[model samples]
Target: MKITSIKLPGDISDESLEALGNDLENNSSTLDIEIPLNELQSSLELNNQQKDLAGQISNKAPRVIYSTSPSILVVIDGEPKIQQNAKWGVEAVVNTPFTLVKSGGSYYLHGGKHWYVAPSAKGPFSMTTTVSSQLRKIEEQSKAEASSENDAAEKDENTIYKIIVSTQPAELIQTNGEAKFASLENTGLLYVSNSSDDIFMDVDSQNYYVLISGRWYHSKTLSGNWEYAASDRLPDDFAKIPEGSPKDHVLASIAGTDAATDALQEAAVPQTAKVDRKSTQAEVTYDGEPQFQDIDGTELDYAVNTPASVIRWRGRYYSVDNGVWFESGRATGPWVVSVNRPYAVALIPPSYPVYHMKYVYIYDVSPDYVYMGYTPGYLNTFVYGPTVVYGTGYYYRPWFGTHYYARPYTWGFNVRYNPWIGWGIGYHYSSGWFNAGFGIGHRPWGYWSGGWWGPRSYRPAYCWSPNRYGGSYYGRNTVYYNRSRNYNIVNRNYSGNIYRNRGGIVSRDYRRADFNNDRYRNNRNPSWSANRSNNRYNDNRYSDNRNDNRNSRYN
Candidate 1:
């Protein structure tokens, strides 16, 4: 369905729009997003009040106004090390002596103030400096050690070599061997046998290694000189692998390693990484113009408005609240926190990214260490802009869209009328009434003294009753306002309704009705009914009284 107009509160600011646009532009390389100047301007105008409401909402603790991708952690030498892989350019282990630099599309590792170059991951390393002096001396002296002997045969007691895992794409190194090792579907870790198999190899920035044949063997390259490793010599990070991880299988295969593995696992798992599977279920409510699309090969319908907060896709209900995502099988959900967000979330149709881009989380790194995966076929089908292309789920589009309905008070802004633009001058909130102000004149008494009707008139019109609980009474082809609390009285025609504009929305409330409808069953006001059998003078007098009361109230 097309949304004709949207009414926003007056609090949203132009500055928020500018900042959002700037963020999108700055991250354009990683997130393939381009916001046309006109679109930005329009969104700013439409959501002018969002900024003011954001501050009010954010004051509540635990409310997240914005969210960034979660940090990635890779265990090294029995300790968990944070990894920064923003934009997927280079994965660098944080807070370590080692750093990675990219030149001409090739990555070089800098460790202990020395540059180690490798053509592809599998490398016979040669120490060289194609870089400047500042970087050459960029070493931490305390952490730095002298270069090791070139010959593999030579061993030094003082030289301690930490096993570095490779971050390069994992390959099926051995296919027909006694045991098969294949890359897991989403994680970079290699699965030794099957999904359930405990044996796995963790990937790091410079090396990929697995505990194989009861020995810790890691390679800087994909294929390796599977060097023998002493259990005590292994880096503390290696022990940080999770209980079910392929790295854990190393402990299972070897004796007396379980105790160490357990300790590392405890330290490896971050508090944030723990998924809260239980979540209180809430009804999914749509607040904006929801565009409905069918899920491929499913009877389910998916609805999205710009910055979609609620999504129904693939017969499942999904929603994002306060940066955490929840999912359920039904629209009215007993939701569970989604540990592994499904691929369907990333494929939430082009309309979502085109409008509500900020809520999009397709390329975010989840607690699972893998980037939230997307369907490459879906990305290929939807085009964000001419130059922006998401190739094979490797890229993402930056979040855009105004926070028009971002606040809790404004969360359920759904109205039946045109949502994109204003419905001609019948008080802004009148749009919520079904077919409000359409085809009908603003005159509660019908064509009064040559007043213009419908869209042609600029004069303020009264077409809806603001009382949400009030009922609309139809008699002799005319509509009357009936208040629930005062059933003894009825508003003849629409004259009792008061219209006032707040923000862009119009609110209508009815004055107390003095005349009882039951008493005037036979002689009801002519304006309240099509039949004018009642005396005109009596009707005119009542009309005069109502008009005087309305004028006095406004005055």
Candidate 2:
């Protein structure tokens, strides 16, 4: 029998409910993505808006745009961080995601397939046939590095995308030539079939709609300025998008829909644990000395120079590593498992960089053990209003002092949510999505992997990589993003204590048949469940671990 769906009773016991959640988590893998040819062609072909923006920036010296087809967007912060390429006697642009080098007053950007050149650091770059011996050596080294990445899955040259170089934040939205609309059966909405962006048009209003992070934005036309369309104000047909339709995924962004409701219920379910304080220890490393930044509306200060989510409140320093909380007196510490986290942590708003830490909780504290759990929000999945959203829709600037400490971003990488993979990046298929081939170690993955801080001994048991092009280097190995589930907190395994050998991994061992034997399985404790204050938000609106009222915040 094909089990289409199973309807469990709403009043299921906590243990049975979490056991089912474990089953779902174990069985679920990332959605294998294949980008449409139209979307791929559209990304390569710049629209009038992009062209106008390029022209506007051309007047600004060393702040120009470079265009290439099916290319990865290489973003640089302010001036390029140039480092000595002593082997080739060239200065390499070390800070950006891709490999860019300066040789003889000209800049060359290598995009795995082709190298682009221009007169300045930033440029109206164009393809050049002429190549210097030094730059050619760099290209050879890059290819050799790509070859050694995963021999079984070597990147084909045909799959290589050209490069798009940008100094400021920019996202590409293009329709392959002109916009093509496809009508949905029995629905009054027409969706743009030629674009990767979730675009739709209401037949009644003739207004264009776009979905981003579960928020609806509307415009009179595709090129016009957009305004937010509240979920409640959206047309009734948005909720009626039929299941399995090409644009049916948009239903999750619509309030009161079955898809949105399912997402909300899933968002409340957490991966819980009984932590042994004596055995579990969290280590935090700073780039240089420890630095702190105040979280808006909270008295607490978070460590901005470290990847480990550490906060200082009332002179006490606390760190949440992998779902386990640890505390110490000093910023750098002989850390011990924490019994109680700061109450002020819940006051953290979406704007704060460490706002995700608010989702990490401490439920009960005994002498030797502290019961703790973290919701999907800790992994950047949040229950926003009536539906669940991937990110907070706020851009947290990455710290680039001595070492780069990257914060979770809302844009740049096209982020989308799938029930199977949680939040994954959506991009033109086969396009080099942050395919950093220049230097192996100095990539965006390394910065995001908490290279600046974390439990040093921990590593992932396995990697769940469904998308070949989404592969990113984490630590020493190539861990591919099923969108952006790379280095996910839920993907790790735990033994004696949760934080003991906590490492970066997407452990396939987590998918075992026996949920009872899984150390990291969702555990529900009677003590914690009764005292739910630990998981409560300031407004007492929703429970992080339990299903709340079905009232739609949008309505």
Candidate 3:
């Protein structure tokens, strides 16, 4: 028997979900059904690779394990699961959306690990709630485009890409209405937010995954939990990891003190540089050991983009920590950088089955994806896209009960899950690596993938054209001088960002002057600099670069 949609009702906490956990061979609410006859007969023969390991994971009924416990851990358990092309040990569809679900009070979990699922994208971001879903997708946009117009358009300084949860998913919640729910998985791990007493956010203990250039590298933890050290921790020997030919084995290595940390060690990563990337802790070694070994020269002064100076938006600044849109100076803070991040988006886990709602961010908007926060273990459960409510969250190890009917829109690509922590989708180049197009898997392979060496430079010439609306808010249909159809405007007055299809312009000087020299050198305004050296800046348009993957973290 095939299962369609199953909804449970209650004031469930994430902790209860964790109690039941992933391997549900015992007491719990389960949706057991017979596999469809046609699907059973249609099971295709496995290739040599999967066939060799079939015995190890060979049960045939593809099942998605949802825990009702607060340790909300979601996954696809049992033998013979249908997920064949998972990049990380988990399995699920690629490029889809999920919603967050919430109700009762905040959810709770006791020990073990819990995963939550949000029903929409707008989020139910209360720390009191359980963690939720993740969205994954496979895209087919060609890595490189044939267009070779040596002369690109000049940029304006008013281009900005405001990244909030998509209105589409937000609308889903408004229309479908919200649901105070529970999961089918009985008694699983769940995590409850702190009760009336405020729990001090775990600055270091919370776990996170950071991906750079497609290659995933985890941080070294002194304890099982993260220490959240500034870049100053690296020894002076840090430098760039040399490019190794594909024939050479790189990406996954146990480099002693030799790995180059310059990119991460020497210079401070520019604010503009981190615009479209993700990073996570790799392996947990040297636990409880002194992590900072003073090579004397190894440690140096690192840079910090405080919530104070670094936070800006429109022509104003807003404190994102509390999600308040108040202008800068309105709320001053050296907001703690705990496991939680500022604007980059967050997600709930799928492993757990308890309710209430889960919150996460849309790090990559293209395929539309968000990774569940405070990742525990990389279990066999893969994330299946979410059902929208407030936002979307995918299921962990989704049951292969959904029909395999090919959608009218199909991306002919495959998912490859490796034990290695880093894995993502992107269009490819003749060269042997990938680029973290935008969000989702923010990092790419550093070697042959030719990781972005430094922060991208987007000046005035790359600013975007104003959207058809406006004229009321800013008092003009379009900023004057930028009337010319130039594509170089990069308005980063807020967080330093280099966005695509950016629009608008506000620089009077840029609008009037010839973008051909270096007379303008305002460290504050990057567009002014690009407007002068129109030569180098125009030559490298962001959209021009060849990003192989769908460019969407979740589609």
Candidate 4:
């Protein structure tokens, strides 16, 4: 039994429904995609659009796009926060045309349904595409199975904190097993722990940057640039933390003196000489930073590995997870870092930026920022500098279209193809038919034609590549010229139906799925969805009619 799916306009004939399914099975995936003659011919004839000498868009092989497909069990491998904020992993399928992916051992059903892995190899895993009585039962089953699997499987190392600083001037740490850096400052420590562990971390030291990257800096270190006292947060109270690790539910009051030895004295004076003592449990951690002074702390809770020298942001004590000392503000969080600083700092309202930047670390002090840099034998300079070994993305911050991504140039096209099949189809149909269907883009795995101008065989050879050889895209209005209301239609193709390629990859534009998650990926032409909000034309009705392909190949 081959499984087929379709989304119809509320009411559809059994014939049309059967036709759609057969079309998918016969023409698409060999695993079981069918198609009918009527829809197939109509779809093909609709694809070939004869414009400036045959525009871009030719047939290419479709891929095996298997969405959750009402599967039995969706195994989340060790639970690594699959639906993370696009910082760790790609977006799991939340909707149709889901990109094939797995996270935390479980796959995201079209991006949402969380299914668990089965125990006995593959006993059972099923769900319902439609929201009916059976669907609810299956959904529960899936959840139960997942929970069982979670209990049995070994989880990913979430919130790992190794003793980065070992009572030495130089100590290193790692983030989510990725980046690495040294907490050179005598006073430095990372705080915060959550369920997910594959978090990246880094210390943003943009302010103290000297001759770090390629650019030769006149300054040297943080102490040279900013106000570096003997210690930043050392206070005038009892100092020196106890030797053992912090146990749970123990009201441990730590204090900080200007000097470690001095702080130790204050600790000795203790209840005898202390004045204006905190009536509450609000005791300071090392270096005078206040932690849950009131929270009862038993000794077995935290393995007091290193001294406390954390960057206090907002009210949370954020620490890096790995080698790269990134930053966080929540103090308590699944911090998604914005900046992967080998050394970054947090700035306050009265922030005194020792260097030229804002808010200290990047990305709202989320979790540990993954360092996008080069490894020793992995990165160097061949063009920029003979020995160029500078950081690239350190300063490059691209938001989801809100920030500027690395856009050297942009290519646009008008997919001028007709969607309707007048009298017949196929060879006699001629003039307009696209391989990947009529309306698609080279960016979205659609074909490219240099507008019958560039090299005839101008196929993209690289990934994340734009068709520079010369090509054009057709607009949804290509069929009716903005006048025909009966235009937007999806019929059928000969060689397996349309399939989804990868989305939300690394792109020059932040809004480009290259950078954004599928949650932000743009659906093609969109006007036919019957919803006004789904219409792309509403935003640029006038500009599109002129020539979106940039090459001016079409009217």
TM-score of each: 0.20, 0.64, 0.18, 0.14
- Backbone clashes counted, model 1: 36
Instruction: Please identify which of the two predictions, 3 or 4, would achieve the higher TM-score against the true structure.
Output: 3
Best by TM-score: 2
Better of 1 and 2 by lDDT: 2
Candidate 2 ranges beyond 4 A from true positions: 1-72, 83-95, 99-112, 119-121, 127-163, 273-279, 364-370, 429-555
TM-score of 4: 0.14
Expressed as tens digits, the lDDT of each residue in 1-555 for candidate 2 is 122333232223556656667676666665464777764564444233223322221111112222223445566644676767555578876555456788888898764456778787676566676889887887776665444432322333444444555655544444544778888778899987766567899999999887765567788877666777766679989887766566665666789876676667656555456666677766677778898988765688888887677899889898887777788999999898776666666666666667677677665555655666666667666765676665565545666665555565444444455443445444332222232323222323222343211122222122223332222221112234333434321222311123223532111111111212211123321111212332322222122212111222211
Q: Lowest summed lDDT over 10 consecutive residues: which window, candidate 4?
A: 407-416
lDDT per residue (tens digit) for residues 423-510 in model 3:
1111111111122222222222121110111111111111222331111111222322244443222222211222221222111111
Decoy 2 TM-score against native:
0.64
What value does the lDDT take at residue 466 in candidate 3? 34
Candidate 4, residue 378: how far the Cα is off, in Å: 21
Runs off by more than 4 Å, candidate 3: 1-243, 247-259, 265-267, 271-424, 428-555
Which 10 consecutive positions of candidate 2 have the poorest summed lDDT?
A: 505-514
The lDDT per prediction is 0.29, 0.54, 0.19, 0.20
> How should the candidates be ordered by TM-score, best one leading?
2, 1, 3, 4
lDDT of 3 at 385: 12
Candidate that beats the other on TM-score, 2 or 3, i.e. the better one: 2
